[model samples]
Target: MADRILTEEEKAAQERRGAAGGAQRGGPPHMRLGQPTEKSQNFGPSARRLLGLMAPDKVLVWAAMAFALVSVALTALGPKILGRATDLIFSGLFSKQIPANVTQEQAVEGMRAQGETKLADMLAAMEHIRPGQGVDFTAVRNVLLLALALYAVSSLLSWTQARIIVRVVNTAVYRLRRDVQAKLGRLPLSYFDSQPRGELLSRVTNDIDNIAQSLQQTLSQLLTSALTVIAMLAMMFYVSPLLAIIALVTIPISIGITAFIGKRSQVKFVQQWKSTGEVNSIVEESFTGHELVKVFGRRDEVGARFQAVNEELRDATFGAQFISGLIMPMMMFVGNLNYVIIAVVGGLRVASGSMSIGDVQAFIQYSRQFTQPLTQVASMANLMQSGVASAERVFEVLDAPEQTPDPAHPETLVDPHGRVSFEDVSFSYTPDRPLIEHLNLCVEPGQTVAIVGPTGAGKTTLVNLIMRFYEVDGGRITLDGKDITDLTRDNLRSQIGMVLQDTWLFGGTIRDNIAYGRPDASEEDILEAARATYVDRFVHSLPEGYDTVLDSEAGNISAGEKQLLTIARAFISDPALLILDEATSSVDTRTELLVQQAMANLRQDRTSFVIAHRLSTIRDADLILVMEDGRIVEQGSHAELLERGGAFARLYAAQFAGALTEDAEAGQGAVPRGVPVH
Candidate 1:
């Protein structure tokens, strides 16, 4: 057999064709919208899972169930009481029998006469009825009292059930939020590199909220509606099976209509959710880069892009809602159909003396009771579908594979002596594109190692390897005498500190930011660390000193100040290994000097890896590694590399050639005739 391919419209047309064919074949006509799927129809699994969340509050669950049961019982009883009253009125009117072979006109006149006589008797009875009239008023009073009691009790129980449902839902939502946050915290850094910040936020905030809404409203309503329907059906059958049969004929029809609408709504809802995420991403991008857009004179362009996403979101939402909205009207139409059928069929049965008028009336009431719950259950399908979609997205993150952890029996580096070595290590961010290859180097404890290279020369990759931010593909790296992989991530990272080219500061007081690396550090220690980084002068200049509140992302602070604060944070930790990647790149010369001084203080007992473009900064390094294309092309101290006249020497000449020319123009002494500028 060959496979068949169909476009979306073709598939829809095929469904309609199939539905028409099925109807022609004498099968039940299939509805086009709100159709339930195999996955959606089974509430057992989701219900059981939700029930487990409420297990801790067993008493509350029991109480809610008890109230719900009482409510259903009372609701069922109301119809029975009304049915009995109807039966009593008919029986009293027809106490005197009529002839079996009566003309239709004569039968109608007899019924009318009986009805007027019954009304007169009822009025006469009411005249004698009075409040505090003892037993005379007891029967009427009892009926009235029972009706009021049923209403009051059902309403109260419904309220109690509502409270319990809210409690369960709220607690479940809280736990789910916590679980998502914990998963995000544990996720590898690389996972974030591939995902957008806005998308992640949408999952956490919007998707989770959708799930919570379903739990709060939809799930409870479905369960209660199901229970009410079952109770109503059981009563209908007990009262009059034939009428119950007529009433139940509407069930399949109602379900068919709902199932059709629900199916269409589910697809729309998924599209709607996706559109919402896109809109969120666009909004987040626009707001975060508002200044960039203005500077680049692209504000209108950005606004247009945002508007496009916003309009897409609106269209998707409207489509989903339009599809879902069909459910209620379809339900009402089916319900009315059932009513008409029950009225016509039941009236014929009454006329033929096969069923009582009371039973017919009761069946009609039961029909409404039945369809009402079915309608509710159908309506809640959208919410349930939304929750399923959200759960899939959330679980996509939760179930993401994590990086392997260190072996349990692996070697430990106690009080790391700061000796580091890279042994022919090769690595690539992706398999096809190698970033670093067959590299070998060693750094001694307390030595400042300067790594110089052109852009994309693996300088940052080297620092990343030392920190074990990525695992090497082919060889090994060692800290002291132990393989870097042997140490736990926490233990290994605690021994290192870094100040990157782009400084990141979280919202907090200046004192808090400084002490971030050492949370338990005292106020004095925090202040001292800040002073060592030359951040204290800035802090004192502010009206609030160290207590000044930093807004989100440290927006209130300048870039240089942010860099200094990050330096202060790294200083407070006092790690054995330090990596500074263009740490002073953003600062002015004055701020650079303060950072250099801070760096000096921080490097006292630490091994440091410094990547610098400003060649003057690396002049005093114990060793300099010049890299290109993922390999070390030259390695030596500043003077010896200059003597080698290779990659490093050429890089040095290029950097200083202009300065040398300027010096010559100023009549400064040139390099000695025999001395090598290299």
Candidate 2:
């Protein structure tokens, strides 16, 4: 069975299992759903390319940086300004009361005569310029107002900065998603066949979403953290070089601890996402094939398998999150330790009068600011790693080679005779192993060609070649004396109609589906096609008749009805060539007979190639080819092939030995008795 993608319910269940908070490293929820693993990818290339994605928004980036600079500058200066306020309060409120007009000697004598000896002594030490008596409320108010203004302006600029950054990120990812979508159209069918649908979906949805989220969250933090660290360090140095140097010691220590913890987490991050994808794959498979699983009584086995993957996911997520989670707390510990050290040393300096109390306070604040960003930077490392990994995946799709080019000068067939000829055609699914070799065939207009073969005998592959789903490896296939390769694939395909064993009816009303092959078909044309294929019999039975909507899987319709719908679709197209591979396999004998009659009528003037394992279906075919492995072992009419007693005769006997005996008992000669030519 073709691998199907996860359904909405399964995907929703996976999401419910994600961490209540979010994925580690700011990746998608899928990343958080898997178990911890050991893998790492170098993000240098993706990172450079990510920056290239942002290259278009250079002006906005510069604007954001400018705003960040202003915000950081104002924020960094806050401590120093607060120190000034402290100095103003200290100088204004605590000075001894003495008149500026009175000399110290006179003040001292007056105080002594009033019997205030402490004041008299303080006055004796006072200089000619007397201390003020009242607080400097006006000066203090101005300083406070200026500090408040700086903060207000800083906040405004920061908001503006955030808006611009958001714009830049949104635009970058918009372009990225657009490129990925465009790349999808350019990619070949082989790419889709080689990759899982869910995996491709994840690349387009989950991975791209993760990249956008990582950018919005981490990019903002990254820019702000960088500025905060720089501003803090500068202020620390300006306050006291000794304290600044002392605080710098914590940088290497914090970084070493973070790097040690973060590196291990980063390695697990890639593994985490991969395991998550694996689990999702299992869920998708089980959900899509739940019916088969239940019918085969494999529910317990499938459940056990799901439980094992879930356990793996839980373990990996715990390991990655547990390791990465230690970053901030450990850095906080180092920061607190550094804070204590600075406080003790600065206290000594203050005691020695080398630094003021206010400077020491500001320095301590600066130390906290400095270490805080160091911690943040270490955390951003994880997010950056995952984002870059996601970018690499998206880029891989975008970078895939495009489909083979169409011919510059294409050939066309006019008044076509529906003649299909395969001349020395050769093809192999793999390059080293040759499958079909120098195969030759000729089909006349309005002839029914039957191809009967065992499993793995390249039945579908041969038909695929004629449809140009795959090109012939060695020789050319021609239609009406013109090489198919010389014609544009689109033009060649327009002339052929196909109905496969697996009926596909997309989500739409009954009429809409029948008209899918010929969008411009009128209602009358659709009704006639439906009647021809016996689709209208059941379609009219529905409550909504032709207006009834089909589900995505089209399960609302019976398998037989679905098959009839597809046949009707092919009939509506009314192409010159018809290819049917077990087209009536889904229906009962009665419906199959009806469909066969309909198909016979449809094939009246068109060349038809019928692929069948049932000998009854192709008994009256104009020409029958019995294939073994990849070569046709027998080719003849029904009576001729039976008379030869070759592979065709053997296969026919295997399917209807009793019928053949009955025919001979009835004196019917060598012709098969199960089915007769009409």
Give me the runs in candidate 2 sitting further than 4 Å from their true place.
1-38, 93-130, 188-190, 380-382, 399-403, 407-418, 480-488, 657-678
Report the lDDT tens digits of candidate 1 across residue range 470-501.
68998999999788898887788888888887
| lDDT agreement of model 2 with the native | 0.76
Candidate 2 lDDT at 161 equals 93
- Candidate 2 positional error at 379, Å: 3.5
RMSD of each: 11.4, 7.8
Q: Rate the local accuracy (lDDT) of all candidates.
A: 0.73, 0.76
List the candidates' TM-scores in order: 0.83, 0.82
Q: Model 2, residue 608: displacement in angstroms?
A: 3.0
